[model samples]
Target: MKNVIITGTSRGIGLELVKCFAEAGHQVLALSRNSQPVSDLNLKQVTALSFNLAEATDFETVKAYVNTHWKQVDLLIHNAGALVNKPFSELTPADFQNVYTTNVFGVAELTRVLLPNMVKGSHMVTISSMGGIQGSMKFPGLAAYSSSKGAVITLSELLAEEYKDSGIAFNVLALGAVQTEMLEEAFPGYEAPTTAAGMASYIFNFSLTGSTFYNGKVLQVSSSTP
Candidate 1:
């Protein structure tokens, strides 16, 4: 079984992703701001830690865990995201900073620290949004959230190119409206075609084999828009 690291595992898709990996018998490191939900599951071969993307020291916790327990990381899924649903005129500099810190900066910091534990055939999958896609449908209240998602897409593509020879693959999934708490926060009462568990299953499968077929690519995994 592979050693996998998944962030944002307290609820919604992240939580389901943890169940999927654990059921498949892979060693999992589940990270989130609130660790109780995952900890309650008490699944074997799963370690849940309270991790905050905005906190600088949390990245070190992951690095230390890998060094102490699992010497190598087979997959890293950057699934934690922050959202701010406010009009563009009301958006402040701090708003953008907070969103970027969780979505973009955190992804980079965690990946940088974990690179040493990752070897050939390792995969890094980042969960983005369809709103991040250029030329796609745009919404008004997501200026900070959408823009931050867009930034990480480019970041993944750049990393994939830089590490082409290292056998590490980076890819982004621009997901559409999924029935998640975050989606409810963005667009209340709107129903999504996909469920968290459904999307999680897809991601679990992709994390295991997507590196062989694609890298530096952004797949638009959506049937509806915001």
Candidate 2:
């Protein structure tokens, strides 16, 4: 069984992912600002860690814990993100910084700290959004969120290329609208075609097979065909 580390495990897709991985017999480290929900699951082989991804300093605790317990992580999934839905004209500099701190900087910083624990054949996956990719439907109020996700995709590509010879794979999954609390907040009264559990299952399977068949690629997951 692989040792997996996933961020944003308090609710929605992140919580579902924790369930999927734990059910698959993997040792999972679930990180979230409020880890009580994950802890309440009481699943075997699952450990809950609390930390705010938007705060860079909070990762020191994670680094310390990982360094003490885990020798290596087989799978690392960056699923935590911040969405600030505001028109460009109304968006402030703080809005971009806040979004990027969680969506992009957090991923980079965590990976950097955990690099030593990622051996050959390990995999890193970042969750992006369809809105971040070119030609995807762009909602006017999601500039900060979309731009940060776009940067995440680019960062994954660069890391993939950098680690190509080391046997470590990096990839991004650009997801379509999924039914989650975050989505409801972004688009009130609108229903998404995909559910968190469904997407979580897909992500769990991909984390297992993706490193072997794909590397440095962005795969889009959605129920709606375009």
Per-model TM against the reference: 0.99, 0.97
Taken over the whole model, the C-alpha lDDT of each candidate is 0.95, 0.90
Model 2 poorest 10 in a row by lDDT: 217-226
Q: What's the CA error at residue 46 for candidate 1, in Å?
A: 0.6
In TM-score terms, candidate 2 sits at: 0.97
> Which lDDT tens digits does candidate 1 get at residues 1-226?
9999999999999999999999999999999999999999999999999999988888888999999999999999999999999999999999999999999999999999999888999999999999999999999899999988999999999999999999999999999999999999999999999999999999999999999999999999998877
lDDT tens per residue, model 2, 47-96: 99888876677788877877788878899999998989778999999999
Enumerate residue pairs that collide in model 2.
none
Candidate 2 lDDT (Cα, whole model)?
0.90
Assess candidate 1 and give its TM-score to the true structure: 0.99
Instruction: Rate residue 90 of model 1 by lDDT.
Output: 95
